[model samples]
Target: MKTVILRSQALQGATASDLSAAVQYLIGVDGGGTGTRVRLSDRDGVLLGQGESGPSALGQGAEQAWRHIQQAVQAAAAQAGLGELDLSRCAIGLGLSGTGVEAQVEAFSALQPGYALVALDNDGFTTLLGAHGGEPGAVVAAGTGTIGEGLRRNGERAYISGWGWVCGDEGSGAWLGLKAMRHAQQALDGRAEAGALARAVWAVAGQDRATILAWCAAAGQHGYASLAPLVFDHAPNDPVAAGFVADAVSELERLAHALDPQAELPLALCGSIALRLSSEFSGTIRARCVSPRGDSAEGALHLVRSALQR
Candidate 1:
C-alpha cells in the first residue's frame, strides 16, 4: 500500500523546548477496513505530522493491522523530521475497527509495538469522543462497515449495531455492495430486469453467471465494498441503486433511534458513506445532526492523554 505523509501547522512556531519533557512523541491512529490514518503530535497535543496506509481493521487480521499501523506511524514520524522513530519513547492511541469482537480485540492488543503507553478502543467509541469532544452525544459511522456509539448526559454509554460485514453492518459500503450483487444475480437469473445497476455490477464482477459466481467465491468484505461507489454513481438513474441507498438511509435512522430513543442527543454522521447520505435522513434525525468537533484520529489522541492521567 502507498504511504502518504503530511506536515501539520499546529505547532509551526513552537520551539523544541515547547514540547513535553516527558513523552517525546504522541501518536493517534484510526484504523479501518479501507485504510489506516495516523496523527503524530507532541505531548502538548500539537499536531506534528500525519500519515496514511492501507486497511488495518482487526477483522482483516491482527498481523495485517500491525504492519499497516507501523508503516503509517513511520511515515508520520518521517514527516515530522523524526528519523527512525523510537517506539519506546512514544505514547500511542488507537481507534480501530473490529473492536466489537472480543477475540479480535485481544489478538490486536497483544501485538502492541512496545510504545511507552498505549490506549485502544473501537473506532465507534473513539468517533463519539471526537464527534462531541467527549461530551454527551452520539455518532453513527459508516464506511466499509457501520457502527453507532453514544455518550449520554447521564454519563452512560451506549453501543448499537456494528456487527461487522459478514452478517451485519447494515447501511455500510459492503452492505450496499452486497445488495447490488444480489440484484445483479437476480437479473442474470431472469428473476429481475437487467437494469443499469446490474450492468454496472457485471462490468466489475463479471458479465455472466459462471464468472459472477467465481467472483463472489473469491470476494471478501473489502472486495465487496469496492463496488459501493458504483452503486452510488448509478443511483440517480438506477432503480436498484436508489433502492439500496434508501435502505441504507433507513438503516442509519434505525441506528440513531436505537442509540438515543428519545432523539435528544446531538448526533454526528461520520465516514464516507454516512456523510454522503446525511441529508437524506428524516426531519427529526436531521435536526439532531451536528458536525463532529474532530476526527477519530484526534479522538485517539484523547485516549492516550486520558491514559496518561490515570
Candidate 2:
C-alpha cells in the first residue's frame, strides 16, 4: 500500500503510451530546513543514484524549494549515468517540511512543474511511513524542530506539536539549544548554576553578554539546532542542562500520548536529537520504540511507486 495520500489531488496527466515509451525512473525528495536529499530508483525499486542540495522546506518559499529539489534530482540522474533527465519520464515524491500548513500544500500544487506523476506530504508523516515500512506506526521527528506523526492500520493519520519555535516544537533540538543558551546567559550573570554545557555555549558565543546576545539575534533554526550537542553532553551532570532535557523529554512523551493513548502502535524516534535521546526514555515510551526501517527519502520513493502502480 502507498503511504502518501491527498484529500484532493490531480495526478499529472499521462497516457499509458507516454509511460511505456520511456524508461521510467522514480525520484524521492526529503526536503527540510537543513537540506534536501534525493533518491533515484528504477521501477523495480532498485536504487540507481542519489544527490543532495540546499534547504527545501516549504517555509523557504515554493520557488527555492523546487529549485533545490530539481538540482538534487539532476545530480542523482547524473550519478546514475543518466544526465539531464526528462521530467516526463519520472515520477517524483516529496516529503517536505511545512506542508502541515494548508496554504503551503496548495502552493506546492500550484507551482509544480510538469512530470509524469507527483506525490507530496508533510515530512513528519512521511518519516513515520519510512520508519514503519508503510505499516501502522508513529514517529517523533526531533531535529531542528519536532513533530509527532503517525499512521494507523486503518488509514487514519495524526500530527502533534509541529508549530515552529516561537509557538510549539516543544522537545526539538532548537528548543534544547535555546534552553542551553539561556542557561549560559544566566551562569554568566551569576543567576544560575553553570556546568560543562553552559561553559561550552558561553565559550563559543564569546565570554561576554553583548556578543552572546548578538549571536542569539543572528541565530536561525539551523544555527540554534547546532548547539544541542553541548546540552546533550552535559545533561547528566549539570543541573541547568538536566532541567532542559527533562522538560524536553516530557514534552516528547506527551507527543506520543497524544498520538496513541494506549501506546499500542510501534514508535520510532527519528531525526538527530530524538535518536540520541532515546536512552533517556527508559520506561513507557522507550518500551514501544524501535529503529526506523528507513528515512523520509524511502517514504517518498514508496509514494512514487504507489502512484505509478495506479
The candidate scoring highest on TM-score is 1
Strongest candidate by lDDT: 1
Model 1 lDDT at residue 90? 79
What is candidate 1's lDDT per residue for 1-310, written digit by digit as tens? 0111111233224343332344578899999998999999997788999999999999989999999999999999889898878776777888988877778877876776677667788888878888899889999999999999988999888989989898999999999989999999999999999999999999999988899999998888888999999899999999889989999999999999999998889999999999999989999998999999999998888877776655
CA RMSD for every model? 6.7, 3.3
What global local distance difference test value does model 2 have?
0.81
Q: What is the TM-score of each candidate against the true structure?
A: 0.91, 0.88
**Cα-lDDT of candidate 1:** 0.86
Q: Give the residue spans of candidate 2 off by over 4 A.
A: 1-23
User: Which residue pairs clash in candidate 1?
Assistant: none
Candidate 1 local lDDT, residue 31: 95
User: Counting only residues 3 or more apart in sequence or on different chains, how many pairs clash (N, Cα, C under 3 Å) in candidate 1?
Assistant: 0
The TM-score, computed over Cα atoms with residue i paired to residue i, of candidate 1 is: 0.91
